[model samples]
Target chain A: MSGFLTLLKRDLLLALREGGALGTALGFYLIVVTLMPLGLGPDLNLLTRIAPGILWVALLLAALLSLPRLFEADHDDGSLDVLALGHMPLELVAASKALAHWISTGIPLALMAPILGILLNLEARAYPLVIATMLAGTPAISFLGAIGAALTLKTRRGGLLLALLVLPFYVPTLIFGITSISAALLSPAGFQASFLILTAISLVSLVLGPVAAAAALRQHMQ
Target chain B: MTTDAATQTWTQRLANPTRFMALSGQILPWLTIAAIAVVLYGLYLTFFVAPPDYQQGETVKIMFIHVPSAWLAMMGYLMIAISSFGLLVFRHPLADVSAKSAAPIGAAFTLLALITGSLWGKPMWGTYWVWDARLTSVLILFFLYLGLMALRSSLEDETLAAKQTAVLGLAGVVILPIIKFSVDWWNTLHQPASVVKIDGPAIHSSILVPLVVNAVGFSLLFFALHMKAMRNEVLRRRVKALRMAEVEQAARGRDTSSATAG
Candidate 1:
């Protein structure tokens, strides 16, 4: 519906005006990738072998850093209360917010992943696979984080708790994302399975996540 | 509608806190006895009765413990999700107790699975730990259990703790499918499922019969322990209330005594 799109646009515009919200995530991703080679030593072979994991992990953490702000701003300013009372179903509202989150955080991370992939000396063949996996996997991050953000909306010390609740859910996406690239680099025949699985996970999350988030929000407001 | 009288009475009886407590208290010893007996028999069958694996030899014995423990870990999370749904939908007090009790039991099962897995891995895989799909996902489940328990403890309000934990419980469901499908998704060295397949359990009955028995035993063990733990939680709540009441009484007495002396 138009309402959902409008809500998504509003969220995106808000993130744009905030200035450093998007920058901070990318900066964290860049720094984590830059630091890995220094700590792991400058062996190109070693870097290449491990680059997929490092890239995937950095993307995951960067995606996670943007999660707490998803609902905190709206909740703090009382916009969330207004939104809750609006005409749209809460699940639709949650879906819109999650889409906005993916656009602001997940897209930027996906765009920057390739540059970091190069820094870690990833194989040229693996670049497309890395991008593809990040594209497929990051939406799930936003969708799932909505539940965490909703649960901790008014709780004290929510940031630490948010990380605790969300990270375990992140493991599968992390594994699949990294494995896609690894499979691509190691054996071309198997990479397709990983990609398909990642896609399947994202599709399932996309459908189920908004409903779960709406449930959490309903519980919170009560 | 009056509905089924017998079934309604059973639910009503369990819903009554005091009656449930007394009933569970009476049944606890018997369930505990059954659990212990079954587990011991399972262990005996695991070691002496089951034939050694042709390829794996003695190391396969580890599967008896590891497989059951792992199965229970997954089942525990499902229980959490179910109890959580009950809390949110039905507003049942017992559901909250069930969810809280499940966390520690789940954590214990997770640890048992990990340890037995490592013991098996040492001989089979030549290493105890790998970032493989099956191992990693299960480890994440263990951490999820830890996080749930931590979240429960961090909140001061009982209602808030219960609500927040239910949310976490529901959110954790996302991992189940991933855990189930990770082997098919990735090129991990871990072997694929041997039981609960579309074609039925892949392993022969010789190995699987004891495995099922132990699995049932472990499940019953979880239920019995969980019921006892929930009872403890209720008692703990009561004791806290009683202590707070006594403190208030003492404070009032002190104030009255001071006023009279003045």
Candidate 2:
């Protein structure tokens, strides 16, 4: 556990210090979100209606933008081999990296979503729901993304392949994330059902992602 | 030992690639005959024998094609999943080819399903497309097939590519049920006029018989195509090996001559 935490801290430190992954993803998110109105015109009612979908999809893409760096750099530099042999297991290393990605990219993206929400004319009432759903949902993106990152770890310039492999898996999260926020406008009960389903998706992926990624890493990491 | 002997015999005998190649070569002709016979007969039955719908009229004929292709679309993915499982868990030699063969076949069937479904829809539902759950889910399934093919093609290492794609292929199996559930919920929310439910008892016996026949025919067709593709893949790998050996030989020849000259 301590070893896992240490790996997580080291990755988080690296992400913060290099300042590229997190900053670029957040900037991309801002730009993508900011352009929604410019593309669709200044229809506040329309923007607010589509806000959850726009926010969730843009957030997913931004999260995806940083996914390639998660395993590629370590694998290229031979650090992953060392980490694989470290106190923690390969699966734990995978989990820790995914967690670090979430902490660095996911959290920042989720936090920045509401700020972008204003630009999209998101409802003031749905603010907490948007943030809450994002927080619950973002881990699944990072964790599942680790599997893609691992599978393509050996291929040069594998970003497109990673996106292809990862985005289909994002369907459930995107559906439920948008659903829960939209449901909040209907009833508390409806919102709870969808929100819980979204959380279940994240937690399920959090477990499956690392194990699958570790399996791929073991297979492909030469 | 005798009780287990028979089971092991089939497994051990076919497990060898050479053995599989010989057996499949012998069986391919018969499989082709069966596929052609069944599909031609099925199509005949579909057009002539299956009674026109009292409601949908002749437009219901599209269901014969659409329904079977949809079944194959789902079944193709399942075939890939099963092959992938074999590759991962049992390390079967032919599993990668089996998985590889299924992707394009599955994508073609999925495209057929969407197109036929649309044609049937235009007449019945008065619109060619709607965001209903089944259509949306099937569209996603098509993308999944494309993604699998893309992943397989991008990697250079034959063994590693096979294993990695097998892993992704297995993960996609989860989407099947989610598509079912989400689409059901989505259609319920929208409550549009459904064309033919496509599932329940509303399908008449005349239509049902041809539908079943076409489904069996399509399965045979998929088998024949899959086997032929796998055989071609084996031959392709052999050609690749020969070329690689030639390249290495040339490189070694240059190295030795340079050494002798020095």
Candidate 3:
């Protein structure tokens, strides 16, 4: 248990020290949001209407950009091999790494999402719900993403293939996330249903992510 | 131990590439006959026997193609998922081959479904497409098939590709439900109530019978195609092995010649 926290802390520190992945994901997310209005035309009504979906999609892509950092650096440096032999189970190790990712990458992305919402000409009332939905939804991105990252850890077509494999799984989260926010904005009465669904997706991914990642890690190592 | 050995032998016998080839070769002709006959009869039923819909008139014929392909598309993925589980848990020797072989068949069926559905949509919805739940979900299913195939092809090492894709394939289980629900939830939130359904109240038994027959025919076709593809994969592996042996022999011969020259 302590080891889990220690591993999580170490990964968080490494992510902060490197600052490369974190910065790039944030930059990419910001750029995508900024570009939406230009591409779709400068229609404030249009922007506000589509803001939640655009934000959710961009959040997903940004989180995807950070996935390779979850395992590639460790695998490349050979610590993954050492970690494979550690006292803590590989499942726990995967869980710790993904937890660190959620805290470092996912949380920051979620925090920045509402700020980016303004650029999309989002409704003032939607600000809180956008942040909340993103915060709830982004963990699924990090956690479920760990499975794809681990599977592609040593493959040649690393980044693109990782996107292809992981994006479909992200669909439900994207659906529920966007729907929940839209529900909140349109009808807060219906918000709980989609929001609860969003929460369920995150919790399911939170548990299944490490288990699947550990399995992929264990199998490929053989 | 003897009983265990007996059960193991049955699995080994079935899974052995050489044996699979021979058995499937024998089964292939019969499967082809079954596919052709059933599909012929099903087509006859679809066009001749099945009554035209009161709503769709002629476009109702499209369901004969669309629904079966849609059914097969989903079933094909289910088959791959089962094979993935087999590879991961049971370590079935042929599971990887089964998963790989099913992709093209599955993708083709998915594409057929989409095209046919679009054709049907033109007359019924007065548009070529509708972003309804079922159609959207099937499109996602098509993408899933493509992803599996892409992941398989990208890696150079056969063994590594198999292991990686098996894990990748297993992870795909989560998407199936999303595909199932994308329509209902989409409808719930923003009902595309304008587009009429193919399987509406107007579907008489005459229309349904041919649809069922055509579905059975397509199943036979899927089975035949699957067996033929699986056989080819087994043979491809054999060709790979023989080539590797030839390369090793050439290397050894070069070594001996170099030694003599020295």
Q: Encode model 2's per-residue lDDT on A1-222: one tens digit a residue.
A: 989888889999999899987889999999998888899999999999999899999999999999999998898788998887777789999999999999999999999999998898898988999999999999999999999999888775689888888998898899889889888887877899889989999999988899889989988755
List the lowest-lDDT window of 10 residues for candidate 1 chain A. Answer: A147-156
Badly placed stretches (over 4 Å) of model 1 are: A185-191, B1-9, B47-54, B180-213, B243-262
Per-residue alpha-carbon lDDT of model 3 for B128-198, expressed as tens digits? 88766677677878888888898888778887788778777777776677655565656532233222355
Candidate with top TM-score is 3
What TM-score fits each model? 0.89, 0.93, 0.94
Predicted structure with the largest lDDT when compared to the true one: 2
Error of 2 at A39 (Å): 0.9
Candidate 1, fnat value?
0.41
- What shift in Å separates residue A100 of candidate 1 from its native position after superposition? 1.8
For model 2, residues B82-187, the per-residue Cα lDDT tens digits are 9999899988888888899889999999999999999998988889998776787788899889888887788888899899899888878887776556645664
TM-score of 1: 0.89
Best-to-worst ranking by TM-score: 3, 2, 1
Q: Could you tell me the TM-score of candidate 2?
A: 0.93
- What class would a CAPRI assessor give candidate 1's docking? acceptable
